[model samples]
Target chain A: MSNKARVPAVDGWFTMDDEPKLLASRGVETGSYFFPKNLAFSRNPAAPTEALEECTLSRRGRVWSWTTNHYKPPAPYISTDEFVPYTVVAVELVDEQMVVLGPLATSCDPSELSIGAEVELVLGRLYEDEDNEYVVWQWKVVQ
Target chain B: MAVEGRSVSDVVVLGVGMHPWGKWGRNFVEYGVAAAHAALADANVDWRDVQLVCGADTMRNGYPGYVAGATFAQALGWQGAEVSSSYAACASGATALNAARAQILAGLCDVALVVGADTTPKGFLAPNAGDRPDDPDWLRFRLLGASNPTYWGMYARRRMEMFGATPADFARVKVKNARHGVSNPNARYRKLVTEAEVAASPMVSDPLRLLEICATSDGGAALIISSLEYAKAHGVTNPVRIAALSTVTPSYPNTLIDMPNFSTDSSFGVAAPERGFRDSIAHAAYEKSGIGPQDLDLAEVYDLSTALELDWYENIGLCKEGEAEQLLNSGETTIGGRIPVNPSGGLGSFGEAVPAQAIAQVCEIAWHLRGEAGDRQVEGAKVGLTVNQGLFGHGSCVILKK
Candidate 1:
């Protein structure tokens, strides 16, 4: 893992740093926030015609809901040849009031999660190639 | 936007047909052609008599599937019938049905044929092939690894927390639907399931076992719709009439965590609608039909997951919110009970053929209303409703009356 270059599976989704946060876009007129950045258009009815501004989302949130996947999803979802079950948590962002879904940190267990539990964002490897590690944002319950 | 009041002209279902729901390993066209012939025969009309044809688009079979209306017409030996195709994920059949209704109401056609057929892939459905990072469907799978069951599990977990619902409640939905399936001749899974069996099944997602969720299957269903005047002219009376067709999109700031979405729309700027998307779907149907839940003799809901079926109970106003399990326990949702749901076994037994499932729901309603659903029949069935919500915020409801 040491020699592999770490890269986001998709660019412009989130940042990789000490305090990671999801990249988002906010409608300038309507004040509506969008995840994965609404690069094309705004869905706001009041201010349907407006430009979106780039922004960083809240780094911490509460668990709105959680689940564990016991089956491997078909592609284009990348996974190891020997698949392992993983947990996913829908985190309700404190500031945005929007529930964002993502896989839990590799260390987290599904049995330990509860609704309203606090969690923070962290970048984790989704899958790795010989030369690169594809990373995506994951949620970890705050200890 | 509010839907206009009731339609001016009423559309009637002259006949319905299906190719059954299962993994047949056959071409979709064959299934569609078979269903079309069956429906035409059931309607007692020749292919040459159909003035319009509407087909539900399927994603798997390339251009022919996309241009389903013409594909089916060609297979059935077209005689210059006007054609239209619609695609709305799982609601494709309803879209096709509504398109036919619109044509009949507009005096464009007196007799119309609506067909939906799909040959689904064996496993979990994947996004369309591409490396396009922008597609949300692709992005969700690539970034979060969130399968369809993962979303269902989240909703189930949330319901358990908010409503004090237990896993057993979810299991009971399967048990009930499975029991109903035992009597449905066209259902894929005809064996009855028990709560113990459901609980023992391997977990697909937390709070959702393998038995609690529906699988993909290959199937076809078709309907023959005609104007009430046309039906009367053709010496048919008291046919099952389409009282209302509600096809609605969610209001802005859709709060539900729907499929293929990474996050809920932020409710920060605009206030969310009073009713959730599913509730609004049923509400629109109620408004258009001028009928309340109390008037429904039976209902056929999209039970993609057993837990989701419970959600539909409340969404369709069978009972108040957080009281679906109570209704289920009271036996009101069973075949003999009041407001019996999924008497034809629903997606729990039928599995999902995507395009065909919604049409199949209407077909089941037609059978029960005509008192022709041998064994699975609901006694004295008059008014029936079918509700289905599709990916990307498409919701459909069809109200039928004998």
Candidate 2:
């Protein structure tokens, strides 16, 4: 690997460790979970005033649904000179009982994946500059 | 518990009009003014006599689009009318219509006008140009490259896996809608499409081909409504009336994946809603108007993708879950079928004009109810419904009757 610093494309959204976990928020009173950490307020209307706490989501989950994106999405998505098609999957977290979306890992074969397949979160390169590599959480099919 | 019949809150639709859907590249104000004039003439109401103007907001346009009510009023020569502007993504038109309906029902205004128009960019609707990480609409694209079609593909894939819906089943929806749109004067594409043609189109998102998805278009639609008493006083009798207008938000713990969001509401703490968000939109209208699915003669549903139209078949209570494909194959949803849908050709033929779409749905339904839809008319149609949902939790269902 080249000598370059690895940084999150969007900070504080997920962990950078080998076993990356999505950072989320859970309502203290209602036990509801929110990905990307809903810091403003509890989204669960049943407990409108419940306090939220920082928590990590389940790393492994089943593929709830998936699609292969053939076209290069428009920006804020940082793109390279050449665009490569990628697979996107919505995974249902094992414990949170909610679905979260992300791209599939670069090494995985999208053709082999299907709904109800198990997958785990891992950090993958989104884009890169001369000095630093930008990374985001991606889903890797579990062998 | 369904309410029996027309309640005192019903508002009469005096007139409806629309600018033809296309990529005309004109200022949205031009389309809005044109549609407004047509509607005013149809209603036989002077512009100066309108008491309130409700405008559906379009974000793609400039500042004037945000204050659309005042903009349209000023474009129509500043009639000093009370104005309101509403924005709810794709549901903007329905939200604006609801605002006008509420004013008429509350006795605040005897006559009100609702208008929505948009001038869209050519390709996939991009988020407002910026590098903001906080916005979910941007984050979904930035983090996962999840364009709107990505969600449509996923939903189509789910139907394929769970309900055994095939690509051919999806293609049939396009063919059926194209056939209906052939006679529509205002539809951007007034032609027939075959299943083979749809199959030959390039795939944009996995199972969804480019032909199966709708494009963005420039168009406008407007409605003139009044209190029932106002219609009677104006020598108009038996006008088409809006029996129920449901603009309801999703209940908590929504599990279905929706647009512009990375995650669904967690059902860990609370039970999932009895009816999913999409199902509840029409359910509320049926409950309020006492017009069950069996009573609907025709429907104008949002068909952003062909497969989604099949999903709406179940969502609107036309068929049970996993039965939309069978419903389409049986030819039950076609023009002469049990319940004709998207008789205006839906977004499949017209493409989408964003803020103007929901109002256009109502406009199509009004035409059939008034026996003015010409060749595409559903004979002896007395009642119709329109359903559409926007990004976030904005969704509406409107039931109209003669």
Candidate 3:
């Protein structure tokens, strides 16, 4: 990897730590979790907007479903010189009781995963420019 | 079956029409106007007699597509008729229909027209051109490169893992729909498809081949509806009537992963709803019309993917969960089965025209109810239903009876 600066493709969605967790908002009264940190208000109608609070989501989950994208998607997706098919997975967190979707780590093969395979969140480089690397959250198999 | 103590009067479908689905590279307004004219002629009502027009908006075109109600009205030579526009992604057609039906029920207008049409681009349907990171549709593409097919593939794979649904089972859905399409003059792909053909087609998303997934196309569909009194006054007797319409959203703690979203609603705090979002769409209609699956002579479900059709079979209560493949294998969902589905070829043959699709489903159902569908008609078909869902939380279902 080049010694360029590391930055998030979309800022404030996650942290750049070695073991990353998704930043999210939770309904203080209802306990509902929202990814990407919804500070606007509580999605639950039973709760008030003042009940919303920011928090980090669970870092580990089980694969609820998965698939391989065989074709390159159109933009705002940034692709490298040659497009490579990647595996997308939906992982269900036990505590949150919700399924979150993301791409598998670049080093992991899709064949290595099953419906209930364990996975953990990680930070990975999505695309890189000359001076900086754009990163996003990815799911890695928990061996 | 009818809703007891029902205060709302039924809306009669005076006539229905469609512009043939294809890759026609033209202005969407042309298709909408053609469909509207055909509907007016079929209803035998003068265009000037139409009191209201409800339009399903298309995003592909510019401001005109966004305000499609006025767009179609202007193209059809506006006579100062009241107009309304609605957009709920794939459910736009049904939503617009519901809008017109509600107006008629509220005594706002006696005679109304519902129209939806679209002229799609070449490839995958992308989000609006912008750099907005706040949009989930845009963020999904920018962050994970996950296209719509990715979700379809995952759903198919989940069915395989949970219910042992094989790829062959999914292919058979396409084959059956393709056979149905051969008789539908308005379908985009009329050629019969075989399981081998489905298998041979390229795979856009694994576990789902290109042929098994719907393609985007240009199309338009329209319906002229009115109060029962209005239909009777026009000398139209025994017209098909809209019995129920459900345009509901997902309940709190919706756990099912849906399209254009990164995560499902967390159910840790709030308890999950009694019914999943998809199940609730048709359930609400069934409750409203008091017509269950057993009463349905035929169904027109959004078969965005062949597997999704099988999922709809269960969601609409044609079969129990994990038993849709069994229903398919038993020849129950085929054209000659106990409850035929997608006799109009579904999205498998027509592809998708976004705004026009849900209305197209209604048109197919109304045709069957009125004994107007030539070869694809279900024998003695009386009651029919159409179900579709848009991106985010839009849920749509409509039930009709002769």
The number of residue pairs in model 2 that clash at the backbone is: 0
Against the true two-chain complex, what DockQ does each candidate achieve?
A: 0.85, 0.87, 0.88
C-alpha TM-score for every candidate: 0.98, 0.98, 0.98
Misplaced by over 4 Å in model 1 are B1-8
Please state the error at residue B70 of candidate 1 in Å: 0.8
For residues B266-320, could you state the per-residue lDDT of candidate 3 as single tens digits?
A: 8886768999999999999999999999999999999999999999999999989
What lDDT score goes with residue A5 in model 3? 97
**Which DockQ value does candidate 2 get?**
0.87
Docking class of 3: high
Task: Write down the lDDT of every candidate, Cα atoms only.
Answer: 0.90, 0.92, 0.92
Residues A21-107 of candidate 3: C-alpha lDDT, one tens digit per residue: 899998877788898689898887777565788899899999999999888998999998698998899999999888999999987
Clashes per prediction? Answer: 0, 0, 0
Model 3 RMSD to the real structure? 2.6
